[model samples]
Target chain A: MLEINNLHAKIEDKDILKGINLNVKAGEVHAIMGPNGSGKSTLASVIAGREDYEVSEGSILLNNEDLEELAPEERAHKGVFLSFQYPIEIPGVTVTNFIKTAINESRKANGLDELPAKEMLQKIREKAELLDIDRKFLSRSLNEGFSGGEKKRNEIFQMAMLEPKLSILDETDSGLDIDALKVVANGVNKLKSQDNAVVLITHYQRLLEYIVPDYVHVLHDGKIVKSGGKELALELEAKGYDWLK
Target chain B: MELKEKLVASFLAFENKVSVDTDSNVHDIRSNAFDHFEQHGFPSKKDEEWKYTSLKSILKHDYNVFPEGESAIEFATVKKYFLHEIDSYKIVFIDGVYSSFLSETSHDGYDICLLSAALKQPKYKTVVDHFFNTIAAKKSSITSLNTAFSKEGAYIHIPKSTVVPKPIQIIHFSTGNEAELLLQPRNLIVVGENSHVQIIERHQSLSGNVVLTNSVTEIFANKNSIIDYYKIQNDEKSASLIDNTYVQQKQHSHVSVNTFSFGGNLTRNNLEFFQEGEYIDSTLNGISIIGDKQLVDNHTLVMHKHPNCESHELYKGIYFDKSTGVFNGKVIVEKEAQKTNAFQQNNNILIDDGATINAKPQLEIFADDVKCSHGCTIGQLDSDALFYMRSRGIPKKEANGLLLYAFANDALEKIKIPELKTRITKLIAKKLGVDLGFDL
Candidate 1:
């Protein structure tokens, strides 16, 4: 579902992702773990086509299509979703309206009609219920004055609504409590199917216990140096990452 | 002749055309006001209050002091300018003359009629004498000019303990019949003890003819009365407006003024409030969204003379292209006005490199125990927020529009009338050139 060919990326002349390669198939969950400043978040930003990073010499392919020339919105239209580590607060825009605009813009890019109001409302209610979000919360400004747990749950709610082909969860578990962690994990599991993929980027092994991963890749100094199964995460948590380094 | 000279010369002719009693007190007031205006011609840029705004170029035109012949305008042609969703008492002026056909006045419980009628009728003579040009700024040359030529405008009087059922709308439309025109409209409103009223005012020009309007309004809120006044300045690019509004509040009266400026060549709003009694509340809120070399300036003042009063002021501006804006809010708390709470805030966003805004807050507090605070902010749109919206598949332009709308939302939230708030929101969206899909 997603491929990175020796992704050589840098920001402001500082090389962050150097000679990294990875591949994930549909219906599978992949976990990328790394220590501080190990380029985990940089990799996610590069895949989402953030303009500040320069892809020195590499390619990011989704369904075998080159994404270098497309703008961020174009990539978003092509079913590439990035759950930001620190979501921005957009004042005066309700969460429901934001989601509606996003869905309609994507559909418009793909030459589809706008979703009818009733169906849109129904889908919003269904997805909101799936994430256990309050009805009043949807009417509030998007991420404005929201708690960390509420923000994470709102992100999961958006992911459910969009149903993207490839979803990258960048540090989704950092601010969640145990209850919020289970809720977000359950939401991701329900949305998982044979036609899509999920990539979890985490600093600890705690989130993996709820979602579980088919494959685990340890990134160090801009390269994936280790690959194992779910047990690898537990072993790393017990022994720390210094031994591997 | 220059516009200033023509106005000074035409004051007598304009006065002769009015049917009011020549020996009345309003006539003396007009004479004194004309003298004041004659002494100080149009304000020069050297004046402190006129420092940021220059009227030299706009006054170069040979404006017709009085509207020539009345041009017939259809209701359908100007219907869009009105708040047509609900029933309203409309006092509409076409080419500086009251259009009886377009007006819906009432004398049932209160008086919502024309100033010309009130000036002539014996029943309304007392109201005309007491409130006409009573609280106007005597030193402002532009205000004096409006007072000297004051004849056509709305006259509203809410009796004691009475409430007007419908909102009042005062609209002035310039027919563009002359090459260059000058219009001066004067309005008076008096809310008796424990009364309430809401007013909406607008000035529109139909064509590309050069139109300069100098309008003045005086309002008196008696004890425990409530007043909500809204000014919508969205005119053609060829139109320029200088609006001076004076408000006086008695004990426990609450008054709010909201100004929304969307389009015009040059617009200056001078709003002043005077608190005469104790425990009064005053609110001043404004929003300006303009682009393409347009200019909008808001100058406001609040005077706290009594004790235990509060005042709040907030103004927001969004400038695009070469557009420019200015916000100058002055608040004063007298020595005896203890326990006064005053707050002022001004926020602006410059959308383009060429856009500019000048925000200044002036506060004078004489009472030591009072609370007075003011703040100002001027910045560009948040790039982080833009990126967030763009990542959600919204285009860059649409994202910018949404962010701008968001920045102005706090001020829009204070509007009490829901329909007017919706209309203003739509106007902001339209000014930003995008559909935000929801009312903020």
Candidate 2:
């Protein structure tokens, strides 16, 4: 469902993602394992179309359409979801409002009718129960003054709400504790489905035990250096990326 | 007369009768305000207050002042704009003229009358005339302009120790066909010793044409009394307004005033609070939501006249379009007013690039024991916050609208009146294109 060939990107004239290539099909989960300063985050950000970063060269195709031709919001509507590593704290904007706006925008883009509050509330409650998210979470400002773990859970909750076809979990395990990581992994597992895809980006292989990926691709210096089966993550866990370097 | 010429003529007309009793402690203030206005002469472009707002637009208007005539409003019409909701000793003024026949007031409960009529009433003559010219008497030109043509204004005297549950509502409806109008509305409110009262004065335009409202309200609070005053100015954007309110506080009295300005092309409000008695406290909180080329200038002065007085002032503005805002606040502590604790803060947010804000908070303390401070800030929507919302799949416009409304919540939270707060919140949402009725 997604294809990338020789993708190059830079932030503020500083090259981050050099030539990179990857391919993924429906019902597949690919893990990109990279050490620090390896352009792992930059790749996730570039694919999400963050304006601060520029694409120097390369092409990304999703559903056989040029992804570069779309705006960040357009990319989102195209089912390109980036679970932000560090979710932003928007003070004074409630979580319910933020999620509602996103849901409507996505529906509008997908040519579907907007869901009103009556049905929306019921859906949110059902999703919240499935994810074990508290109802009070809907009232607070969007990640404002939230704990690190709550933010990660909220990101997954948003993913659950959007029901994106392709979700990129960018370092979603970085700030989670063992318990929180379990909760996050459970949420991802519940959301997994065939005919869709999940790209799990991480530094440590510890997250692999909870939600195992179908393919493990070692991303070193902006390019995918190695690709293997799910056991490859456990192998990397046993022998860290430093040995690969 | 030419526009500038008429203003100069108006100020010229009031320059002579400006006087204060020498034995009274406030005589020097009277002299200062008189000399200030005399030299300034109705704030032309040369004055800072008149920089963005030009009175010349109204001066060139070749309209006659609406003479007092038959009132179009009934007691039921009066009930619409009333604040306290229930039975009020309602006072009505049409075209700045006191309507005697349409007004229903009773001395059995309190003292309410037209300032002109009270001047002739035997029992109320002393209290009525005591503050008539004392509030803004300093600007002989201003009082001269209003009083020289004083056809009508509300004069209230609350009896000692009487707590009025229902707020007295004063309604001014301008009804005339003239191309231009000039209204000199006035009010003299006296809260008797230890009494409590709330006064709401709502200004409306029936003509909805180019007009000018030059209004002044003078409030006097007796010892140990509390007075809550509210002013809502929603006039036609084409109209020009200049409202100057001078307030005096007695010993141990507390006075609070809230000004909500939503309309007018160029509106200037000068609110001066004097803490004359020991332990007196006063606070002035105001909010203005502006659009287009509207200019709202609020100049405030807090004077600590005696020892142990405390005052607090906060004035905020949310400016949209190419509108401009000016908030100049002064907190003055006299030498005798030792241990005075006064604070002032002015915060403004400009929604659009073309919008502008000018804020100056000043404090002059003559007493060493006084604690006085002031601060002002002009900030815009946070770019990082905006992008964060946008990244969540929210459209750029919808994201901006959310953040902008959040920027206004700080001011909306300060409105104490629940009904008014909800109304203002909805009004803000409607203006910012959050038509779904934002739940604040």
Candidate 3:
């Protein structure tokens, strides 16, 4: 469902993502693990079309469409979603309203009519129930004064609502307690299907136990040095990343 | 002749036209104000308060001090300017002349009528004599200019213990019958003890002619009274306004003034509040969004004369396409005013490189026990926030608009009137060039 060919990206003349290549088919879950400053987040941001990162030489494709020329919003319209590690706090926009706007804007770009208000509410209710989010919480401002777990859960709520073809969870497990992490992982596992893909980008192997991935890739010095199965996560966790270095 | 000299020469003719009784107090006040205007002429950029805002270009117009006559305007033509969605007492003017046909004034338990009537009527003379120009700045040259020609405007009086059922809307529409015109409107509001009132004022030019307005308003909030005043300055690019509003709060009184400046060639708002007794609360909030060389300057001052008083001030500006904005907030805590709490904040977003914002916060606390804090910020929108919103499927333009709206939402949230809030929300959305798709 997603393809990255010799992905070379940099930020402000400093190369962050060296030569790297990865491919994931639909319905498969992939986990990209690395230590600090290992370019795990940069890879996710580059796939989401963050303008700050320059793709020096590489190409990304989603469903056979070249995403190099598309804007972030256009790529989102084409079903690419990035759950930010640190969510922005928009003081005036309620979470429900933000998601509503996002959903309607995507629909508008795809030449679809706005969802009926009743249906939208029903979907919101269902999604909130799925994530165990309070109804009142949906009315509050987007991520303003929200706890870390609440922010991660809200991001998952958005992913569930949009139902994107490819979802990249960039450090969604960090800053979350065990209980909150379980909720987020459970939601992601339930949302997985044959027509979609999930890419987990994390620094630790703790999340791998909850939402197990079909393939594991260790990113080091801006390159994917190793690729293996789910057992490789336990091996790496027990021995630590220093052994690979 | 220069505009100042012409105004000086036209004073005699203006006095003759009004035909004021020279022996009365009103005549004395007008002549004295005229003398002050003549002495100071127009403030130059050399003055510290006027340093950022220059009146040189605006004063060059050879304006007709008084319009020829009442140019009748249809309600259909100017209906959009009013908050027509709800019931309101409207005092509308056309070409500096009161339009009785378009106005709805009341005298039921309270007075909501024209200033001309209040100045001339024997029954209202006592109230008018006591409150008229009592709180306005005596040294402000432009304020004095408005006082010199203060003949007709809105006059509202809420009786003691009475709460006004509807808001009073004072709108001045310049018909542009002359090539260049100048209007001076004087408003007087007196809220009696324990009474409450809400007022909304706007200055609009009907045609694309050069129009300059010098407006002055004086409000008195009696003991335990409450007042909410809103100023809407969204006029044509050929229009400019100089608004001077002074408010006096008695013991236990609460007053708030919200100014929304969206469009104009140049707009300057001088708002001042004076706490006369203890436990007075004053709030000053403003939102200005301008582009294309438009300028909006807000100069505000709050003086705490008694102990246990509080003042809150917030002003936000969004400038784009070479627009200029200025915010100068001054808070003074007198030596006798102990335990005073005063806070001031000004935040600005300049959308273009050419857009400029000059913000200054001046706080003077003579009392040792008082708490005063002030902050100012001027920057562009957060690029990370922009990317965050864009990645959520909202386009870049919409994302920018949303962020700007949120930045200005703090002041907008203070609007008490629901319909007016919705209207202003729509206006801000329109100003930001986004639909927003729903009511904020």
TM-score of each: 0.96, 0.80, 0.98
Worst 10 residues of 3 chain A by lDDT: A57-66
TM-score, candidate number 2: 0.80
Q: What stretches of model 3 exceed 4 Å from their correct place?
A: B21-23
The lowest-lDDT stretch of 10 consecutive residues in candidate 2 chain A is A89-98
lDDT for each residue of candidate 1 in A1-245, tens digit (9 for 90 to 100):
89999999999999999988989999999999989999999998888888889999889999999999988888889988888888888878899999998899899899999999899999999999999999999999999999999988888899899889999999999999999999999999999999999999999999999998999999998889899998999988999899888
Estimate, for each residue in A1-245, the C-alpha lDDT of model 2 and write its tens digit.
Answer: 88988999988899888898988888899999988888888888778777778888989899999988677778888888888888877666688877887888888878998898899899899888777889998899888789999999999899988887788999999988999999999989988899789999998988999988999999888777788999988888888887776
Model 1 per-residue lDDT tens digits across residues B1-440: 87777887888887888766865688888889999989999998799898888888889998988885877789998989999988999999988988888989998889898887888888887888777887999999889888887777899999999888779999999988988989999999999999999999999999999999999999999999999999999999999999999999999999999999999999999999999999999999999999998999999999999899999999999999999998989999999999999999999999899998988899999999999999999999887777777777887888888889889998998887888888998999899999886545
Question: Chain B, TM-score, each prediction?
Answer: 0.98, 0.85, 0.98
Candidate with the larger lDDT of 1 and 2: 1
Q: Alpha-carbon error at B261 in model 3, in Å?
A: 0.4
DockQ (Cα-based) for each candidate: 0.69, 0.38, 0.83
How far residue B188's Cα lies from its native spot in candidate 3, in Å, is: 0.6
lDDT of 1 at B327: 92
Shift of residue B408 alpha carbon in model 1, Å: 1.3
Better of 1 and 2 by DockQ: 1
Fraction of the native A-B contacts that model 2 recovers:
0.41
Interface RMSD, every prediction, one decimal place: 1.2, 2.5, 0.7
Error of 2 at A200 (Å): 4.9
Predicted model with the maximum lDDT: 3
lDDT of 3 by residue, B28-58 (tens): 8888999999999899999899999999999
